[model samples]
Target: MSKLDKTNEHEEHTPSSSFSREIEKEPGGADIQHCIQCGMCTASCMVASVTEKYRPRKLIQKILLGMREEVLTSELPWLCMTCRQCEERCQEDVSLAEIFHAVRNIAAREGYIPVGVQKVVDTVMEDGWMLKDGYSDFIEDDRDDLGLHTDLGWNNEFVKKIKKRFIDGGNKK
Candidate 1:
């Protein structure tokens, strides 16, 4: 038998099928099967433009070949800026951004989130906001300074009720 046929026969009985099954469980994975191996994505990627090692084409190839560990652990997965440039440039409209998002979620589920991303997640969880510098402290100009009436029937009671509802609903972090 030919080498290709022998390899296929060997893979049929191997644990590699489990990795294939896991990849199938990913949402939109069916789209991956339709990839034509065009290098447009890698050509248009800004990261790939600057970095010799960060090519989306190589990523697609690895995923197609079921290189689970390499695809998941590579810095290339986290290097995506989510710019959608690759998606926009794709002739197949393959949703590369969605694929990257799936990869990131898988990495996170496997407890592989990089320290920088984990710090951002932790800050958001703690502050209920993504700003690392905390809320801006701009002082509101007084009504007198703006030459307007200070008491224009603004209802403090209504504002208080809204604040109480938000706090009770666990949204007041």
Candidate 2:
């Protein structure tokens, strides 16, 4: 109610920054300024539903506020499923999934990737799949039980080309 209290309230709020504006200059990243903090994206996020830590709404706010290191170093950006459910329901039509991807790209470039993500990349690069290379003894029995072919679908040649495209191409996927 007092003048001093009003001024303190204004000072408590940090200013938005040009980081998001810079990102907006890139393709598919122009909607950063349109976020209204409505929490719709958070509510609709499949990851957010399960994890209290991976809120895209809060991440966008941090980006607009220029908390670059915090957002870049955290595992939050990698957690996005890119399902587009948040974008579909957003009132401002902000490309939430794209924004997340942009942040992830930035983080990855800076060598801030989480260990789990690195493992996934390594697995795909080495085997063209998420699981470990080579088949298990039980796998054949399971396939037979389901009346399926015994082919484990490990195409070494195709995997080699994929590895060259992604790993040898400066991580281009």
Candidate 3:
């Protein structure tokens, strides 16, 4: 057999153990196994409409095939805007948004967070809530003039507790 022929063999790829099942155990991921690769979800996806790289059906296929590492490390899962357009069009009732979120949970725990997501997490950790990265020094002067706290009134203690309970506990998100 030619080397290319060997590489193309269907049997060369072995599905990992229960990668789909792992997602199924996650919230909103239970219906993943029922996906029939109908492509309806992809047809209805707005993200897929706008971007060539984001394909919902393909992601499901990879998960069902147990391409665990590829799925987890991919930025495609995070590209979903959770608009539910795909979910509405899905005949199998697969909750693609939820399934992707579940994948994100697993990916985050594995420290595979995308840069944009990590920035939000970092902001929440620093200020006890989300603040724009451009929150300027001049805002302090304005707050002082208005007799308001320069450090917005967000509860730092709550953020800290949440981080300790979630991220530090090995279930990082």
Top of the candidates by TM-score: 2
In the order shown, what is each candidate's alpha-carbon RMSD? 10.8, 11.3, 13.3
Residue-level lDDT for 131 in candidate 1: 53
Judged by lDDT, which candidate is best? 3
Q: Point out where model 1 deviates above 4 Å.
A: 1-21, 134-173
In candidate 2 the C-alpha lDDT for residue 171 amounts to 42
- lDDT (tens digit, per residue) of candidate 2 on 1-173: 64335432322123457778766776667677878788999999999999898889999999989988888899888888889999889877778888878888777888999999999899877656675433344676888999998667867566555555554553434
RMSD of model 2, in Å? 11.3
lDDT of 1 by residue, 1-173 (tens): 64335432322212233443565468744345445677899988999989998988778767777888878877678888878798787766566766777777787888888787888889667554565333221222466677766555645554444444443443442
User: Model 1 — TM-score against the truth?
Assistant: 0.63
Per-residue lDDT tens digits of candidate 3, residues 58-169? Answer: 9999998889999999999999999999877776567899999999999999999999889988977765557433333466689899999877765656655554544455
Ranking by lDDT: 3, 2, 1
The parts of candidate 3 lying over 4 Å away from their true place are 1-17, 128-173
Scored by lDDT, model 2 comes in at: 0.76
Per TM-score, what order, best first? Answer: 2, 3, 1
